[model samples]
Target: DPTQRGGVILLSVISPEKYYQTSPLTLEACRACLRGIAQLHAAAWENTDLLQKATQQLSKASFHLTVRNPKELATCVESWKGFLQAFEPHMKQAGLWDKPSIHAMGERIAKLAQYISDQMTPSLVEQNDTTTTPQFSPYATLIHGDFKAMNAFLPKKYESACSSSDDNQH
Candidate 1:
């Protein structure tokens, strides 16, 4: 199961308070999460080597998941369309469909794919045209692409436990 795609290894059990999507979260947890992600981003930000490795792993871990090629742009577009269709009901219920930004985005779903293709495609930029240079954004960081409320987790501060000998002495 560890070798499977989407599998995770949780090593820390000393921290009893684990926050998940359904769990009632404190503002501190959210702040801590932001702080942690900021650290993660700072550590890997604009590191092309690390980014490439992460991207390669992501592509290998999924079915038909090459995202760095301009050819993959169509796939991105179709996937977005599929996602929009699948989530339309929920969006409507949540009043997101009526939002101006969302409505405007509905009109230009292909632009997201175009932006990715232009900014992330490995082979070339400008829709694979040779005249354009790779538009690797300086803003690139270790982003969790699939980060969602369902799988979200927040760490809690834990106090170290005293040993049996120490407890006996106390």
Candidate 2:
């Protein structure tokens, strides 16, 4: 029948309009955003079954993913090293490295690289492994990979809806 379709149809919505910030975010606004992010993280982490299912789905999707592993840490270190190697020559050409402050900053970057390398110990990697339920080595949880101020939103209607739902739950 026309009223009872068996197949599902998906609809996509797009808007050409952009939202502009009228003013800089206040301290209270920043705090509120942080609170919202914490809430989101807690909710996702608490759901173990969902976490496992999502992990499985991601694996099946063949996505290269790592959570608090030595390899991931190494990748970060490599990224920093690559950045330094690629930019240091340019900085020197620009006479930036000649400055005492800039030279000190370069030394700091080198120290940071050493620190990152030191953190990749076997004991630490074993401790961070998700298989073991340690007290607090690495509380790996679903994270918003691209969380930023630009992506945050707080519509009154959504807040009211969430509040009402929470009240119902209580």
Candidate 3:
């Protein structure tokens, strides 16, 4: 329906070229899938239709368990120590693990926590340095926030179909 505001609808896949969740087990396949996702990001960046209709409710860039939430961030910080205690040996066996790397991971959690804290209450955050915050393109873009193996599907080849996925977010 052209009169409808939604852009996407349930797509019926054909017999020969059915959409499947090719869950990118190999490095090259993962790269290809990620490249496909990147294209979607670029295409949807600051699309006028999205901006006009859903800007107010959907301005937040990321929709995750921890993003923009102070308590979840703090919980992550506490969990980090326990995670290290449980998985340090396994991580060491995987190699490339070191004290500095461990510290850096903790530092990232702290920075994100501080960022959320500052955003929520700037008066108390004396070291409210915005530089450490993750940066994105100035233009706001809609993303496949739930892009994963279960949620994303691909045709036999990317050439035959669009590299888009339905997240059912809204």
Per-residue lDDT of 157 in model 3: 69
**What tens digits encode model 1's per-residue C-alpha lDDT throughout 1-170?**
42245534445544335533422234454455567667866775666677666545543222222433445544655665676687787677667877767655534655654554334432212356646533446655565545443345554341121112232111
- TM-score, candidate 2, is 0.36
Off by over 4 Å in 2: 1-24, 58-138, 156-170
Model 1 bad stretches (over 4 Å) = 1-14, 18-39, 52-98, 117-139, 156-170
> Could you give candidate 3's per-residue lDDT for residues 23-109 as a string of tens digits?
423344456667888897667554545443433444332432234455656577677777777777656765636767784676587
The CA lDDT of each predicted structure is 0.48, 0.44, 0.50
Model 2, 1-170: lDDT tens per residue?
21123222334443324322212244444565679789866764545555554444432211112223345444664665565567676567667656767545544654564444233211122455667743221343444544565566643333433333432210
Query: In candidate 3, how many Å is residue 108 off?
Result: 1.8
The lowest-lDDT stretch of 10 consecutive residues in candidate 3 is 117-126
Question: What ordering of candidates by TM-score runs from best to worst?
Answer: 3, 1, 2
Pairs in steric clash, model 2? none
Q: Model 1 — which ten-residue stretch has the worst lDDT?
A: 161-170
In terms of lDDT, the best-performing candidate is: 3
